[model samples]
Each structure stands twice: as C-alpha cells, then as structure tokens.
Target: MTDVRVLIVGGGLAGCTVAKMLEDEGRGGDVLIVDRDPQAPYDRPPLTKAFLGPKDRMVQSPPWAPADVPWLADCAVAVDLLARAVQLASGRVLRAQTLVLAAGSLARDLPGRDNRVLTLRTVSDALRVREIRSGGAGCFLVEGAGPLGMELASTLADDGASVTVVDPASAPMERLLGGALATEVASWAAEAGVRLRLDTKVVHAVPVGDRHAVEAVFSDGEAEAFDCMITAVGSVPAPMMLHGSRGAVGAAVVDDMRRLVDVDGSHFEGVFAVGDLAFHRDADRSLVRSESWTAAKNDGEAVGRQILGLPAAAEAVPYFWTRQFGRMVQVLGAIPLGAEVVPIAVVPKTGGMLYQASIDGSTVGFVGVNAQRLVAMLQMQGGAVAEWVAPEV
Candidate 1:
C-alpha cells in the first residue's frame, strides 16, 4: 500500500480547490487526489448554462500547473478510518496522514429509472443531454422545478423543444425563495412560454414505443407522452465510502472546523468533511449542508487553510444566483420560511426588483431579480436594514 501526506477523494471543485491551495502553499508533493472520472476537473455551473448552447461555448476550468501531483483515476470503494487507508475499485490500497472527504453528490434518481429518463449532474450527463437536443427531440417533460430543472427547461425551450416542468411544490423553488418570490418566478416562467404544472408529480415513467419516448403518469391519473424526460429532483450526498466502518467514519456529522464527527459527537483527528457531504452545525446548533458552488469553494478553502496551520478566513455570507427567463435571480443570506418579504425597490425600466427579507422585525436576507449590483453593494456594506436606503426606481 502506498502512503501520502494527504488524500483527497474527489476531483470536483472542492477537491481540486483544496489541492491547488495546498500546492500553492508549497505542499504539492504531499498531496494525492483520486477521482473516478478520468477527465481533468472542470467548472460545472456552465453545464446548465452556456455549455448547453452554441458549439463555441466551452466551459472548462483553468488547467492546473506542476502536473506532478498524483491524481489517480480510480474510485474509493471503501475506507478504514481507524487505519487511515482507502480501498479503490481497482483493488489498490492507499493510506494518508490526513483524509479529506470531498466525494460530492450524485443526482437524485427519478421514481422510474427508465431508459428514456435522464438527469444532468456531470460532464458526461450534460453531453448526453446535448446530444438528445441535437437529435431534434421535441416535447420535453422536466421533473422537479429546482434551479437545475428551470435552467434545463429554458435551455430545452431555446433549442426549439416544447418544454413542460412539473413539480410537487406549491410553486417553483418555494422552499428556498419563499412564496412571494416563488410566485414571481412562476409568473416569469409562464411568460417565457414554459408550462408549469405546480403541485403535480409524475407517479412513474415507462417507455412507450420504438421512438425512444416516455409516457409519464401524473398523480391525477393523467398520462402524457414526451420525446424525452429530464429529472432534476436535487441530489443526495455521496458518503457511502464512509459507511460500515465500525463508527470510524461519520459522513453525516461535521463540526465548525469541518472535521468529521464521530458517532458520539466527537471530532475525528486528521479526517475532514467538506462540500456536499459535510453537514456543518451552525452557531444556532442547526445542521446545514449547502450544495451551492460558492459554499463548496469556501468549505474547501477554509479546510485547506486549517490544514496548512494558517488562520481561517472569515466566513462570507452565503450567496446563490441563477439565470432564467432572460433575467438574473440572486439571493443573499438564508431567508427562512415565514420571513417577512417586503418589496424594497422595483425598476421596470431596468427590469430590477429588490426585496428585504426579515424575521421578527430583524433583517435576515435579501432577494434580488436582475439587481446584481445592488445586492453586491449591500453584501459588501453589511449592516442592519435600519441604515440602508432603497434606491429610488
């Protein structure tokens, strides 16, 4: 068995970022990254955006220099935390002084894993979807109304496919954006000609005939056939590698320092959990697992700094944005459910709207539609809402 100073189990944004940070701090030779995908790591956000469009829109991360850091194109099938060793699918065993679990997550599968159903979570998945679009598949049915579903639906519609988005949520992204913003987004989606079937679900999907289509059965016993079906029902953390380890690996528990917590709620030395697999206990004692790109990057960087014996950077406010229906929707901070959503500004000429979200008379967050500049300014000048003034629109 080969041994190294550090072993990172994923090569996605979080894992690669950690490797780069470590190398930049003059620890390149001590790190090894193992990823199941043989291809070099690339940015994933564009997969749902530009990469699905024109042929020239290629989305790839900047190439890593020094090329000497070992990146094993293998999957970690099991882990022995007590012995600090990981077993790969190819039967190779690796041990490390410190283990970083950044395995990321997989796209949640649909109810029916039929041949006609697809989900976009990787480069290969995106390519397969692009191929389907190029093949002139019409009448696309998208399951789930999350950001991925909406983005993919818009992309498919742009590609000349009649698209329909069905979700069991009362409104698209209601749990995340609250009812007001969700209703606004639903209206925007309708104006874009993409049909929204709110509070609806697909019971099952089955292949109809030789045309490579799927007939989806709804909750109301209504059946509809489409040339293709894409499910974006979110993702679940990929932490199976840490399972069945006799309480040595705790994939679901993490402390503020990103260290893996044992079954007894104690931190495990030299074992860190970051990215989607990390369930961080906030100051409020609530466990939060953020799946956004920014959150993953911050998690990796913070853990890397901690490993290097450097002072951890101050945590930045959580941020997420998406492009859909010819507008940019951005959210800053966590807007809890039942929060008071007050319209702060609305500019029809610039197609911008800003809402101040409060809880019990205290500002908690801000949601903006096509108001990136305002949101960024507010984030930079962080303070209570009492002193802030909404721009006259």
Candidate 2:
C-alpha cells in the first residue's frame, strides 16, 4: 500500500482548493488526489453561463489547480476509514494520514428519456449540449426551473434557440429569491423571450424517430415536441465511495473544523468532507447543507488550516450567483424558505434592483439583480447598509 500524508477523493473545486492551499503551505508534496475526470478541478459555473456562445472557449484548465501536483485519473471505489486507506477501481490502495472527501454530486436526469436528455455536470456534458445544438437541435426543453435550468435555458435562448423551461414550482427561483424577487426574475425572463411554464412538470417523455428530438407530455395534459431536452432537476450527494467505509457517510453532520463526523457522533480523526455532498456547520452553529461553490472553496480553506493545526478563520457568508438573460442575480447569506423579501432600491432605467431577505425584521440575506456595485458595497460593509435610495433622473 502506498502511503501519503493526505489523500483527496475528488478533484472538483473543493478538492483542488485543499490541494492548492496545502501547496501554498509547502505541504503539496505530501498530498495525492484521485479522481474520475482527468479534466476536473476546473470551474463549473462557466459550464452553464456564457458557455454555448460561439465566441466562448471552454476553460480546459483553470490556473487555480497546478498540474505539477500529483494526481491520478481514476475512480475511487472504496474507503477504509479505520486505516485511513482508499481503494481505487484500478486495484490500487492508498493510505494517508488524513482523508478528504470532496466527491461533489451526481446530476439527476429523467428516467424515460434517451441519451439526448442531457444533464450539465462536467465540461464534457456542456460540450455534448453544444455539439447537439450545432447539429440543429434548435428547440430546447429545459425541465426544472432551478438555477441550473434557468441558466441553461437563458444560455440557449441567447444563442437563438427556442427555449422552454418547465417546473412544478409557482415561480422561478422561489426557494432563494422568495415571492417578489423571484417574480421579478420571472418577468425579466419572460421579457427576454424565454418561455416559462410554471406549475408544470414532465410526466411522460419519448424520443422522436430521429432519436435527437423528444416529445414530452406535461402534467397539465399538454404535449409538445422539442429538438432537445435537458434535465436540471437537481443533484444529490455522491459519497458512494465512502459508503464502504466504517460509518454513515451521507449524514449532514460535520464539525466547524470541516472534519467528517463518524456514525458514533465523533469526527473521524483527520478525515474531512467538503463540497456538494457534505453538510457543514456554519459560524452560527447551525447545520447548513449548501451546494454553493463558495461554500466548497471555504471548506477547502478551513480543512487545510485544520490539517496544519492553524487557527480557523472567520466563517464567510455563503454566496452564490447566476447570470442569465444578460442579468446577474446574486445571493449573499442564507434565504430561509418562506422568508420575506423587501426591495431596497431600483435603478431608474436599467431595471436593476437590490433586495433584502428578512426573517422577523432582521436582514438574513441580500438579493441583488444587476446591482453589482451596490451589492459589492454592502458586502464590503459586512452586510450592514445605509438606507439606499435610487438616483433620480
């Protein structure tokens, strides 16, 4: 069995962040990363936004991850937590002093669809979508109106493709933007010529004779045909490799130090889990399960420091953003379900708005649509803001 100081299971943003940090601290030589995708550890947000454009070049290698660092392009099949060992599908065994689980997530796709029903997860998936579009799949059906679906639909619509977004939810991004803000977003989407079919879901799907186009039947008893259908329903934690380990792996329990908790309620010594799959405890002592890219990056930093026995840094506010239909929507902090959203100000002609998400009169979060400057200012102020008044014409 080969031995190392640290063994990382996934090579996504979280995995790369941990390695980059350790490398910065001169511990890079002791780390080894095993992942299924050789082109992984790259930024994924770009895969949906500004990706399908003709002028856009796929970012093959992000500068954040160094190629000099040691890594293996192989899938991890099992983990032995008691011995801090990992078994790869290639029949190789690696034991480390510390184990980092950053296996990311698995995209959920519709069951009754053919190979044309794509889900955007990796750069390859995005490339396939692009290829099909180039091959004349002009009409696109994006199932699910979450951030992924909305972003993909926007991207396709921007590329001159007829796009229809269907979801069972009442409004777009209602989970994060709440009622008013989400409705505003939906309005913008509609104005941009995107077809938003809310309160609707695909109940049946079948491929056309060509196998590229799909005929889908919605819950509203309406049937439509599209050249392409993409599912952005959502993803679940992919800690399947750790399932073979000693304890419960998918539990939403991790210490503030980013250490993975064992089934016995004690954190596995030097074992950490981060990114999409793992649940983390924030500074407020509340357990938060986030699929945010920012959270994964933050987890990498915290886990790195903890490994080095350094003092943990101050917890950062969870931040996420989506650029769709030439507008940027950003979320800072947490937006609880059914929270109240209050508009702070609106730009005179640009249709920009800054909103505050409140729970019981306290600003729990901020939602900014095309208000980058104002949002940056409020973020710099540590979420405290003066009364914002829109400038008059």
Candidate 3:
C-alpha cells in the first residue's frame, strides 16, 4: 500500500488538465496519474483531421505540463470510495486524499467483431489508420455518421481517396443539428465526393477472403466491400473502478461542481469526475452526457479550480464542432430541434450562415456554418451570446 495526495485515474484531456493545474501550483510530486494507454495525455481533436492528413502529430500534454509530471502506466482494477483507495492490476493499493475519475470512454463496436476492423480512439489507432492510408488503402467504409466518422471521411476524401460513410442517423449529426440543417451540411459534403448512407446501420461486418479488405452489410440489405473499414459508432464510458457504492449508479454521476453525487443526492467530499464518463447534472436538473472536446477541457478547468479552492472561471457554454467537407460547423450551447433560429450572417455564394437559436423565447444555442468570425464572437460571449447577436427583425 502506498499513500498519494491526489490520484487521477485516466490520462486523457481531463485528467491531464488537473495534473497540469497541480503542477502549475507546485504540487506535481503529490499527483499520480494511472492510465493503461501508453501515449501521454494529448489533444484529441486533431487525431481525425490534421493528424490523419499531413502532420501525423499527436498533441501530447499541455505546454505548461513539463515532461516530468508523474504518470504510472497501470490499470485501476477496483475502487473503495469510503477509503479513497484504488487497487491497481499489479496488486498495489493506492490510497489518496483526493480522487479524480477522468477515465474517459472507448469506441463502441458494431454488431459483428473482427480485430481487423478499425476504430480510431487512441494515438495507436490513429497511427494504424495512417499507416494503412499511406499503404494506398483508397476505398474506405466509414461506419457511423458521428463527428468522428465524418472527420475521417473528409480527411480521406481530401486525399483523393474514396470514402463511404454509413450511419443509423437520419442525417449527419441529426441529433445535434436537426434534420433540416444536417441535410444541408450533408449536401456540402457531397460536393467533395463523400458518399453518405444515412438512416442505415451495419448489421454485419466480415473480412473478405485473404485480401486486406472488409465487406459490410447495412440494414438496408446493401453490401459494400472496401479496401479498409472503420467504425466510429460512438463510445461507452470506460470501465471505471466504481461499483454503485452508496446508492451510486454504475456511472460517474456528478453535479454542477463536478463532485461525485450519489443517486440519493449525497456528495462524496473529495471525489469528482470529469470528461466523457461524467454524467453531469445541469441547472435545469437534466443529466447531460456530452462527448465534446471543449466540454471535457472545461470540466477539467472547473475541477482543477475546485481542488485548489480557486475561484471558479466564468461558466463556459457547451461547445462542439466538425470540419467535414467544405464547411466548418460549430455548435455552442444546446440547440434542440424546432428551436427558433435567427440568422445573423449568410454567405449567399457558399450557403454559409451563422444563426442564434432559442427555445421558449430565451437564447440557448448558436450554430455557425463557415462563419468563424461570427462564431468566435458568440463563443467568447458564452452565456451572454444572445445579447451580442441581437434577435433579427
């Protein structure tokens, strides 16, 4: 058994952010980050974009976090919440005063299984995908129309490779942009020669005979065989070391402060959860689970502040973005379907527009298509973006 001041389980953006915060405050020696993944904490956004394109670079750690920040390459097998103790795979028990569960999530697979089938979630996955692309795997089957799938498809298409994206959603990111706007975005992607098969799911996937190719059959009874197949179906919370202790769900349920809260509404004093694994409770009493990169970093900031008793930063609006074909779509806050949209800017030539969306007469979200300047103004305003972009007449 060993004693630690702070034990951060996971080395993704959220965990690394907290580690960086501590190191900035001269507490680096007291923090121990346990992660199974070999790569150091890195910015994940570029993995699907530039990393897969030309640079092939991994944004490992924030600039402020020096090379010496301690990280233990191990797996946490179990957790004892009351004792604040975690049992590692090597039979070592680490007891800490503060526990931060930033264990992120892993990609969910399709119906059938084959190790050859690819899914990009880690540095290794990206490298493997890159290697294959470099080897001339031109025809690609991208399963799932989520941001990840779309980003990968775009990257390949830009390289003059054939990309076919299949997903169960009615449109690309239909849940985020609504059918109307999502369809419009898909149209732009079409211009780049990216084939989209929406409202479809892969019922089966199998590697074609000795050849380095895979054939996937969609629910629509259509089958396509490609040189390579990748699935970005979505992600499930990584297996953390919690077992519903104290009436807690088998999830990292946390409140607005990112503090772990029991299902019965009780808080665990020095314990918190951040990143994709956290099921966060908002002011509206809604349990929102966001997989946005911005949200993960923001959660880490909030947790780091709380851990050091520092004053909280301004409340950050939830954000998400995707650069598919000829468009860069940005979403700030929550924009539900049927929300009132007030267009602020529009580029008639490219069909790019920036708009503010609201529900019940109160601004709640902003959507921008190829409007970076307008989007920045709204993002910088955070909750007050509504005022910055006054309602159109």
Instruction: Report lDDT per candidate.
Output: 0.80, 0.80, 0.80
Error of 2 at 382 (Å): 2.9
- Whole-model lDDT, model 3: 0.80
Query: Candidate 2, which segments miss by more than 4 Å at Cα?
Result: 54-56, 243-252, 281-288, 347-351, 383-393
Report the CA-based lDDT of candidate 2 relative to the real structure.
0.80
lDDT of 2 by residue, 1-393 (tens): 999889988888888888988898888898898888877767888889856753245566776675667989998777776678888889999898999988888888666766868888877888889889988888999998889999998888888899999999888876666654666778778877899999989998878867568899999999999998999988877645554245545563677677777766677777888888687666776766788888888988888888787898877776888888889998887786788878777866678888887777776788888888777776665423223232322
Report how far residue 97 has shifted in candidate 1, in Å.
1.0
lDDT (Cα, tens digit) per residue for candidate 3, span 35-128: 8887766777778887565443675455534355778888887777767788888889999999998889999975675887899998888888
Rate residue 380 of model 3 by lDDT: 63
Tell me the tens digit of each residue's lDDT in model 1 across 139-208.
8899989888898887777766799999998878765676557778878878778999988899989898
Model 3 — which ten-residue stretch has the worst lDDT? Answer: 384-393
Candidates in order, TM-scores: namely 0.92, 0.92, 0.91
Candidate 3 global Cα RMSD: 2.6
Candidate 1's displacement at residue 198, Å, is 0.8
